[model samples]
Target: MEYFKKILRFAKPYRVYALLNILSNIFYALFATLAMISLFPMLAVLFKQTEPVFEKPIWNGISMGKEYLMEYLNYFVTQKSESGSPGDTLFFMVAIVITAFFLKNLFGYLAMYFITFLRNGVLKDLRNELYVKTVELPISYYSEKRKGDTIARITSDVLEIQHSFLSILELVVREPLTILFTIIAMLSISAKLTLFVFLFLPISGFLISLIGKSLKRKSDKVQKEQGYFLSILEETLGGLRVIKAFNAESRFSNTFKKSTKRFYNFSNSLLNRQNLASPTSEFFGIAAIGVILWYGGQMVLVEKTLKPELFITYMGLAYQILTPAKAISKASYGVKKGNAAAERVLEILETENPIAEIPNPIEKNTFESGIALEDISFKYGEEYVLKNFNLNVPKGGTVALVGQSGSGKSTIANLVTRFYDVNEGTIKIDDVDIKNLKKESLRGLMGLVTQDSILFNDSVKNNIGLGKKDATLEEIIEAAKIANAHDFITALPEGYDTNIGDSGNKLSGGQKQRLSIARAVLKNPPIMILDEATSALDTESERLVQDALEKMMRNRTSIVIAHRLSTIQNADTIVVLQKGEIIEQGSHTELISKKGAYQKLVEMQSMG
Candidate 1:
């Protein structure tokens, strides 16, 4: 119920539809009672009970208001003479019953009609908000979550809320109101009989509540299992080549089968428990009906205190409570199931972004002499990855970082982009602290080409144009020419329009890296960061990518995180790192003359 309140804010825009639904439900409830009461007149006439001597009058005293109403209604049933045929009165009685039923169904349809807008409206806004949150959240957030779980939350969880919980809102309002109207009519006939009917209700309610107590726990398990298998399916599709090459189909299949087996047992238990509500409630209702028959029969036959026709009408009203009662029981179970999904959705929406920008951030218009890191330190966890690190890249010059794995070469690139802020000291661009600058303005000055070329499932032109949305086709081709990717791209069947097919799988690794460089070239930022851009390629591909990379870096301040020594020999400055500290720094000539860490690394790689 608390989760429902949180989700209700999405419904604010559709209040008009919600109000109309409530109003229509009121009419549906009233008509449902009228339909049941219509049975009374037929029961009286068929029992030969509505004769002039014995038609039960609605009022006892001769008050003008009550007397006038009673006479007005009796005018049509002029007590068929005792000698007249029963068919004379029975025809009119049947007409009243049919008319009552027709009006009930008509109002019920109207109730559903008004509720449709509210259900779909909430669904539309909920999905929109979830998508916005996913895009707005910082990149670091994705490092800790499973993509398929997030996907399940957006698609399947929202659909559950729509079909299962939202559909019950129509019944929640209408069923309770229908019960209220029917109970009031029963009291009008005889308060004592109505009182007897309600005595067993609380006991029945307690039993139904027991079944739903564990439904949420079971439902949460089922949804989690759904995400687990979905994640495996998503990964398998993306890495089918790796899986087939390693012959690991049995391993993935076993993991998938285990998750599905848990889902099977959980769904069976959850649905079976929910299914018990209908029959359990019905059985209790019938038991109550049997008791009422014995007691009410004594009142009519032995005590001669109640009329048979009125008593029959009272019994009909008592039975009417069962339908709505069963519905209420079912809705209670639905709430339990929906609560789990609602909590999952709210968890994402309510998550506080840890890396929000400052209220009033600075803006650096341009990079001047250089970017500098002064005693900067950082850690992805407890152990610092970059401890007291320092470097500088003068504008229009190249500085390269060479280090073994886990020595923080990539962390420096991440810090410059502000993907993760430094923990210990300040980083400045042209003497201005980067922390003071607006994030977008800081990122606008730079372009990045990483080891993995992150391309979308779109056309070659669209993929490159991501760096600059309104870039013309001619501009895109120019950038690709600089990247040395123009030949292969033009050779494709659709040229620039051909789809890349998920992370550019249609292209070779070297071709994809070239395309990534073309995107950066299209952006044409004043500063560039190339982190292992050519390390993953063969010698031939590396030479080609390196040549294109050098062309793009011609007039830009470039920071290259390199693994191969051959790539950085001509860098304006090369820094060698070990154990989160700088061990040597100089040009290739100066570092080799020092005969220290840089010289040792060059010696080892050259020998290998």
Candidate 2:
């Protein structure tokens, strides 16, 4: 319920729709009760049971209003039967019943109509917030979380909230009001019988509540299994090539089947429990009706304390209570299921981001001096990945980092971009601690191109334009020319308008890398970070991409993480790292002259 209330805040903007739904439901409840009560007058007329009335019934106070209204209705029926035909009196009573029923259904439709806006409005707002949070959260947040689970929260959990929580808007007012109004009508018919009805209600309610006790816990398991299986599906799709190449389809299939079987079991348990709600509540309702029949029979047939017509009407009103009671019972189960999903969704919404920007952070737009990692130490979890590591790249100069795997080259890029903060020491840009700078403004000062060219399923032009939101087509073409991608792009079926497919699979590796370089060139930032950008390409592709990289890095402050040392031989400075510490640093020629780790790595690659 706590999470339920938190989700309800999303509906505040559509309160007018909620208010209108409530208003319509009130009238619907009134008509629903009146429609049932109207049956009594018709029965009275058909059986010729109405008493004679010589004079008009007098106006009475609220307590005796029911008695006065009954007498007045009997008096009118008597007049109609006396003045016209008995058939006319029957027709008039039937018309009253039909009108009550018509109004009931009319307002019922209006109630549903008004609530549609509120339900969909909350859904749209909730999804929009989820998407914004997904993009705003630090990249490290995803390192330990499944992408599919996050997708499930935004998609499935939100739908559950709509099914369960938002639906409360319909059930909360209508069902309770229906039950309340019907109970009042029952009391007006026979207070003694109504009191007897109340005795059985609490017992039935308690029993029904017992069924829902374990529903939330079970529902939580079901939702989590749903995320688990979805994660498997996402992973399988993303790694289909590897699975086929290794001939490990059977392994992944068995794993997926196991998850699905668990999901099937959980879903069965949850839905079976939910299905039990309707029949259980209905059975209790019918049991209560049976008890009423026994007691009310004594009053009407044996004791003569109640009228036959009114006793029949009392039974009708009593049965009317069951519909709303059943509805409320089902809604209770829905709320339980919805509550579990809400908790999962709120977990993400309420998470505190460790990399949050400080208030009044400095907005740095220029790189006047250089980027410096001063005695920085960091770790992903337990052991340090970068321990007291330091490096400097002055403006308009390239500093290349060459190391084997896990040597913290990429960690430097992440820390400098504020993707993750250093556990100890500070990283400063132009001597200003990067922690003091606004993250967006700091990232705005640099361009990044990684080993895998990250392109989206969009047009070639749009992919390049991603570097600058409002980049013109001419700007895109000029940037492409600079990165040597303009010729291939124009040769495509639609040229700049060509769809790149998923992750730009439609283009070759080198073409994709060039587009990435072109995107960076379009941004034209003062600082560029290349993380083994040409390591994955073939010799020809590497040459072309290296040419593009050199063109883009000519006058920019660049930090190049090179897996192939030959690419950085002409760099202004080369730093060789081992494990997590820098072992050699100098110009490329000087490092080779030292006959150290850098020289050995170059010799090893040459032998390969």
Q: Assess candidate 2 and give its lDDT.
A: 0.92
lDDT tens digits by residue: candidate 2, 78-164: 789779999998998999999999999999999999999999999999999988988888999999999889998999999999999
Best by TM-score: 2
Candidate 1 residue 145 C-alpha distance from true site, Å: 2.5
Write candidate 1's Cα lDDT for 1-608 as tens digits. Answer: 79878887887898898888888888888888988888877886677565453454455554354244335335445555444666967887798899988888887888788788999999999999999999877777888877788888998888878866786778877999999998888777767777886898889889878888999999999888887788888889988999999999999999989989998999999989989989999999898888789878988899987888878887888898889988888888888888899988888999887666778998776878899999999988889999988887889889999989999999999899888889989888988888888988999899999999999999999999997979999999999999999999999999999998999999989999999999999999999999999889998889889999999999899999999888888899998888788888889999989988888888888733
Off by over 4 Å in 2: none
Number of backbone clashes in candidate 2: 0
Clashes of 1: 0
RMSD of each: 3.4, 1.3
How do all models score by TM-score? 0.90, 0.98
Error of 2 at 514 (Å): 0.9
Residue pairs with colliding backbones in model 2 are none
lDDT of 1 at 467: 79
Q: What is the C-alpha lDDT of each candidate?
A: 0.86, 0.92
